[model samples]
Target: MAIDITVDHAVATLTDGTQLRTPFWRIDSDRDGHHLAMLAAQHGNEVQGIEVARRFADLCAEQLVAGTVTLVPYANLLAIRHRRHSSDLGPEQPGRESQGFNMQQAWPGDPDGNDIERVVYALDAKVIAHSDRLVDMHCWNHFWAAAVLARSDNGVAVQMAEATDLPFVMWRNSPAPEADIATSSHLMYSRGGVSMAIELSGQYQMREAEVDRGLRAMANVAKVLDMIPGEPEIIDGPMLEPLAGNDVVVEAPCSGIFMQSGLEPGQRVVQGLKLGHIVRDDDLETVVVRSPACGRLWKYGRHDMKCDVRLPDQHPYASEGDMLALIVQACGPERE
Candidate 1:
């Protein structure tokens, strides 16, 4: 028999005087063994995660038989509201970075710090401390809607990823040298809990396939936590294990009108294949973009003049030295 679940919403105030609200769905049953916290849209442009969180909130009302589930669909409220990646701290709170401080990097934030910091503090005090496991939904930059990557160091995180029954769990320990234990997931992991980050395709626009995959992964995560009833229905698939590291950023060699070769993430390519081109608008000369190695396409940024607007929203034009694409070397795995 199904159970009766109730939904509730809570609000919090940031030091910068930003008030944020979140929704929690509670299922009162004897199976209360774990607590799961999900954060979506840490980057405002990423919306597929929110859709996944919403679908889980709707289905888990009855599916969650044991523990409680807390879902914060929009972690950066001001960013999402303004349709920007960083928070709307305005001129007064100018961040360290030229554009602004990314919410993901300003973790363990100062109470008297900037707007994002206060918000992070609120989430840490209210959400991270109370959860047994955390699943953070995020999207890569405006690139090819690529394959999914599940990242974690803790066993519980790995278990949660397995429960999501994703085909292949790409465990990346080699983040950029700058990666550390300051982000929200890192906070949860440091406190002896498990946290996982799910990167589901490109940002700035919503993709239906990406949203469905995310929903399925979360459903499995709940099952792994024993917060929800039923066997995890992880669809069979191929998992991409990182060889060197997860992110292999390719930068544009020169500034020009970018043109693509119809290359996409998830497309397998051999070495020397032409990936894209840059045309000098003045001379009408085109340069060839080629693959340096043989691997699957993990991500590729699209251009405004190139990307198909038929998909609702196309990304902006690429600038010189911008992140052109990210390639996850598909090779051997299991290394610290």
Candidate 2:
């Protein structure tokens, strides 16, 4: 099959002339049905999804070939340009402070709007307007791992997850009150296009293995969409969660250099279990950080704070109500 390729540029232009480019490539196949697009680096730091799109492009350009495939590698160039993964959640870097408004959050964007929203408007016009389904990739802050989130039962999203067979499936069991305007993923769904957010492992420091895994999975997803030929192997081990409605803050009871005695995410714990300890700077006594409930450790903060400092400031000590760790009750076997 002969594949046709095109690079369409958006109306928005950065100060550096870095226009948003959408690469549309496809080979005409008799069975071609669904139109598919995979977007990566909506948040610049989540590099694996972008890597996946790169590999999918290469594979389509070489081996498995069919259907229409639009790959938007590094959708948020400004964020990627600044080398920050997410623009919404964390503190901005010293020089790139203006890159707020999480790119993923801005959807069906405002053309004559703020920088981030303007970019979204351009993307909505240039790319999203032409696609039936999308896969938006994301990652956690520096210290956390990865997971996959999808609007459950949405046909395209369900098929996409089954195709990739990723590590976890975060089903939106209950929608957030602001689900309508919270992020681009939700906005995309509201606009009649099916979309899913895939989170990959590691952060800040990119790893080739994770990239390869993400790419391979995405390529497999394309095959599921009939955009490519040949079935790709499915990977297991995904932490499936019934969409969390709350951002439970596990704060530091007292502050210290959080000495987690080999504590890791996904580990089960009981109430009063000493998960870690906060050490005093001047060779003083250490305070043990214990679990508040009998549950499993699902997530934790990457940085430790002292007892004296306020949250997000990273003061080495802690005060009351400071976040420490997040624990969740286990359902059955761990997703694997």
Q: Which candidate ranks first by TM-score, i.e. highest?
A: 1
Q: Which residue pairs in candidate 1 collide?
A: 168-239
| Candidate 1 overall lDDT versus native | 0.66
Model 2 compared with the native: what TM-score?
A: 0.67
List per-prediction Cα lDDT, in the order shown.
Answer: 0.66, 0.62
TM-score of each: 0.69, 0.67
- For every candidate structure, what is the RMSD over all alpha carbons to the true structure, in angstroms? 6.4, 5.8
| lDDT tens readout by residue for model 2, 107-135 | 77786666677788887777777777777
Off by over 4 Å in 1: 1-10, 14-18, 22-30, 88-101, 108-112, 144-153, 163-170, 174-181, 243-264, 267-295, 301-336
Give the C-alpha miss distance for residue 2 in model 2, angstroms.
Answer: 8.2
Q: lDDT tens digits, residues 1-336, model 1?
A: 565656655455666576666455544455657778888987776777888887888777767777777787877776788665666534322223324357777676666776677667677666667887888888764455433344555566667777654423566562454567667766775667777788777677888877887888888888877777778884543455545465466677766656778876656656677888877555667777777766666666544332321242243245668666556554433111
In candidate 2, residue 263 scores what lDDT? 62
